[model samples]
Target: MTTWLLYGATGYTGKLIAQEAVERGMRPLLAGRSKEKVQPLAEELGLAFRIFELNSQTAEHLEDIDLVLHCAGPFEKTSKPMIHACLKAGVHYLDITGEISVFEYTHSLHEEALQKNIILCSGVGFDVIPTDCTALKLKQALPDAVELALGFDSDSGISPGTMKTMVEGLGGGNTVRKEGQLTDAAIGKHQRLIDFGRGKKSAMAIPWGDVATAYYTTGIPNISAWIPTPKAAIYAARLLNAASPLLSSEKVKQPLLKWVEQGVEGPNQEQRARSAAYIWGQAANADGVIKTCRINTANVYDLTVYGALEVTQRLLTGDYPSGSWTPAALFGPDLLESLPGSGRFEIDSFYPGNAN
Candidate 1:
């Protein structure tokens, strides 16, 4: 049987994935930088475990591992090292990352991954799967699509790791793909009323991973992603944008990160069971033709568990193409519907009244 390793196996989302993986009868080697955390989980699950920080010796640890499902983040820091190690070791790489830089970086390694005959798939989680798939679906519906917009809203709580990643991204403000290039937009500069299957809500464009991945998935020249935001948070985002340097500083970020560490563990079981996430996307062509789609799924973290494992199970079969790929690029838009709690995509196409 093909075997794999689960790094960051003790994290909140990782623990859920680990437990579910065991319940599904797979014995992945549990791993993380901290033996204190990783070992206990391995013991509890009765699975093999390993401890190793991301470093030059990382590839040495993958000798017996066929694939790696990396749950560690902020992946902007953690992904490169593991990816380098995976490339060297000829092991397939997958991660639940939604970070734009990480996705672009991994995409840069596409040729190397293809050369090594190992798949480098990122954003396997809620990060981009639903939106990425939506982008593809929209593109398919309107083959001439030149523009894409995607937004998601959820009542789910954030994890400390995710919080830290967001903090680290404060310096980036907002980003969107414009005419095939990444363009920075000021925070709160791009707001839209998106109906994410739950009435129209005010959403602000953010530096979502789809600003990178959706372009790759759909070959659309323009793209943006948004999330519902209140007026107060929008004001704060604008202030943070002006204070980007402070947020980028370790001295300034440490305290906030520490608070997240102590106080934020992400949603509990009940929250995971009840919370749902909605994704909305649209594509437009020069002719003013529009295509739209929406997906409702389990909470982002819960979807991550299913999405990661779904990709993991498929990669284990050794049937997927070997190259860096977004989920939609690898599995088609249907992959989103395949998730355990995902609702079928609701799609519509029409010509705007303003169309010439």
Candidate 2:
């Protein structure tokens, strides 16, 4: 009956996940560190609740649960113990984490899950799903893809929790794979101007774990995609990124992150009024035949909810393939092509690399 565990049932994204679990006609084992946080919502949805501490014994917790939907995140902190519990209990698992550190750490467990036949997937949200989908589609369109560029733009608004997480990533060094080798880049240093249809904008190079995974999955030699940002905002981030190193001195990163988190939550009404995300992709082979396209998302955090709903449904009904995997690897090219074209943003492509 897909008796899933709804970990982090109390956060912004977690609530949406809880809502989805109920709509699926399943009473997930709604859980968190405090019964108080999850209980009120559990009552609203007519679902039962269970308290789960970070490192507590879980033999009792895993007794009958078939799988776990780890909605709680900043996965670097919570993934290990919960994963340990699941592995010990022989329960299958899944989560929505987008951090490279977290994904790399989880990727390390590949053999472990394979040995036990447990399914572990990270970035079930906006992190790499749409990006991955588009990348796969390009590969299909171009049989021999040599180098790739993927950009993201969305008119999406992020909630506090997402901001909190993004803030946590600030100034920290992030690595991406290049020519099958690892290269480290700071959060906002690598900036570029991009066109998102709404207007000309700038994007920063953040360590989006997708770069590493996509390279590994598709065998693409060169890859990079710029994230969406208004031109002015891009320059602003460039400035901040320049200062990120200094701000990130071991003693200062946390306080700065805390400040940024507050800004996300308490932005002026105008700041909150406009937000977005957009994804664009490029691919080609030795002949220089390149395919280019874009995916537009209007709201950032909300899409996480939307993508999660789609992925969870796929997971629940077995719509997805079985494996310890990533979003791009799972959803693939065809599904992305099938995504409905909308007014806010469109994922469309053209080929012209050979002409130049």
Q: Give the whole-model CA lDDT for all candidates, comma-separated.
A: 0.90, 0.68
lDDT of 1 by residue, 1-356 (tens): 68899998887878999999999998999999898898888999999999998999999999988999999998999999999999999999999999989999999999999999999999999988889988999988989999999988899988888998887775778899999999999988888788988998878999999999999998999999988998778878787778878778888778888887888888898988888998899998998888888889989998998999998998887498889999999999998899999999888778877533
**lDDT (tens digit, per residue) of candidate 2 on 1-356:** 77778788888778876786677675778899888788899999998889878785964787788787787767878888887787777776777777777777666777887777676777766676667776776777776888877767654456666666765666775465677665786555566776644566766666776776666557787777677655676567656766776765756767755765566542333543366456677777776566766666534454565666666566666754445677667666544434333122234444454343
Q: What is the lDDT of residue 3 in candidate 2?
A: 73
Clashes of each: 0, 23
Pull out the clashing pairs in model 1: none
Deviating ranges (above 4 Å) for candidate 1: 353-356
Query: How big is the positional error of residue 17 in model 2, measured in Å on the Cα after superposition?
Result: 1.9
TM-score of 2: 0.83
| Model 2 alpha-carbon miss at residue 29, Å | 1.9
TM-score of 1: 0.97
